[model samples]
Target: MTDIRIDIREKVFPAVGQAAAHAAIQDFHLTLHSGEFVCLVGPSGCGKTTLLNIVAGLDRDYRGEIRIGRQQALPKIGYIFQNPRLLPWRTVRQNIELVLQESSAGNTVDFLLEAMRLTRFQHVYPERLSLGMSRRVAIIRAFAIDPELLLMDEPFVSLDPPTARQVRELLLDLWRKRPHTVLFVTHDLREAIALADRLIFLSPSPMSVIGDIRVPIERHLRQDENEIEAFRRRLLDGAPHIKQLL
Candidate 1:
């Protein structure tokens, strides 16, 4: 088996200065292996993003341990937030290069620029690029670090249906080229099933694992209308409650 492993045990987080002290994750636990594409799905306000932040070492107020492999639980992580969050003043290429420079991996900028198909808009500032183009730059910036784990928090949430579909395909292509453990958080069941090897569902608030389903489809499968619809149906079957929302 691969040496890469992610283990989260009894994780919990409480919001501070709130009328009602809310628990974001109550005893949440999971294990992930290398090259696995895992998608986390849940209703709104389920603390999915909070859990991701903890794993990424952005939030340290949580209980329980997160271990990677047999080592001391430290793994380089790349985070993609809901919005592109690119600097308006910087061009597309400059924004990506900034992240690369931060990671001291400036040499990888050229490769990432081509891989993300942002070469054409390399000199275009964030304000000049379309929403989809900006998001693509963000994705490339995250991946440029060559992180062992990639945490994507609804990175395509703001795109239109067609644009989102294209981005999904592009992401899959990138995943194939560079295999890493990916934890993608999204509310869209279809997107989850279409991209992930395993789908994990969380309960409402104070989230806990409600369901775990393995998608048997191959990664090479084309994302056609029929395939997407079938995958969506399969995901709904795995989590019946999701049917009402769809």
Candidate 2:
């Protein structure tokens, strides 16, 4: 687990093609405590992905300060993108092992495969697997290395309700077993409430922090559909702005 402090003063995109130069993120500040699950919720086309990219060191052309731990050490990072991004040629187990070293890759792979219910498909190729299966493989691959900081960008989008629910449960199970600081970005308010310990809402274009809400439901009660719905209703009814943007 790792503590993360992010203070992005301004993140501007250079003019390209017909699009003019503009600020995607501005005056955004957040601190993720170790082993906490935080969700970023906002409108589509906002700077959610931009923020994740900055934190993951994918885009360095930005003015900000991102520190990990007390002395600012580089933390072990795991990223799950919108798509699975798995190697189609490799088997499910091989694709997961691709990110782990000899020291880190062992029973960890088998444990994750079994936890995610992918043991039967471990030898199967990515092309033969369904999208949900691919997503599960991508998830375990991220967990295989035992990352201290996990960054996810709307990883469960476009799936059917049943598939999405099952995947969410699997992800929660993995998270409970291996606690880590998670910075997850999602568009679904209910999903955010169900998964996140804290929720951060962003503005439309010049993305900035608009709301910070802590989920009030107990961890054990989060699985109940009625509890989730009731909590979501109370949260939305109390905050009109959050309801509008989310």
Candidate 3:
């Protein structure tokens, strides 16, 4: 497990011909502690993805520093995108096996495939699997690397309610077993409440942290709609402004 410290003073995208330069993120920063699950919640197109890109070291045309633990070099990072960006040519098992850097990844690959209930589809390619099934494969691939820090960008965005809930359970199950640092980006406040140990709210673009809190209800109680609704009511009663964006 590793602690991540991020300090992004600004991130700007250059003008595209007639369009003006857009500042997606400015003065954005976050610190993720070792082995904790933290969710960044904000409105759509609010630069949540941009912040993840900075933290993941994907976009470098920014002014800031991101330090994972004590190292200058990056460790093995596992990322799950907004879509199942699996290699179409590869089998489910093969897609997972590709990112592995060591021999021990085989055992992990086997365990995660069985755990995600994708053993029967291990030999199937991405094109053949349903959306829900493909999402399962993506989850397996992310965990197969046994990464120290996992970054997820709305991994359950388009799924139907039941399927999304199932996938969320599977992800948390993997997180519990692996126990590593996770920086999950999401727009759904309810989903954030259900998944995170701590939740940080962000303002709409040129975003910055507006509020932060630990989940009041236990993980087990989160599934009960009554409890979830009650918590939401209590929270919103105190801060009516947040309800508008959420």
* Cα TM-score per model: 0.89, 0.96, 0.94
lDDT of 1: 0.79
The residue-by-residue lDDT of candidate 1 on 66-148, one tens digit each, is: 77666656588889999889999888878877866556655587777777787788898888888888888888988887888
Q: Across residues 1-246, which tens digit of lDDT does each residue of candidate 2 receive?
A: 557889899999999999999999888899899999999999998999999989888988988788876655557889999999999889998999999887778799989999999999999999999999999999998888788889999999999989999999999999999988899999988898889999898889789888899998988888788998998899889989878876
Better structure of 1 and 3 per TM-score = 3
In candidate 3, residue 163 scores what lDDT?
Answer: 94
RMSD of each: 2.6, 1.2, 1.5
Candidate 2 stretches with Cα past 4 Å from truth are none
Worst 10 residues of 3 by lDDT: 67-76
Evaluated with lDDT, which candidate comes out highest?
2
lDDT of 3 by residue, 1-246 (tens): 567788888888899999999888888777788888899988888898888887777888998888877865565688889898989999998989888866777788888988888888899989999898898888888888778888899999899999999989888887888877888998877888888889888888788887777887988888887887788788768876677778
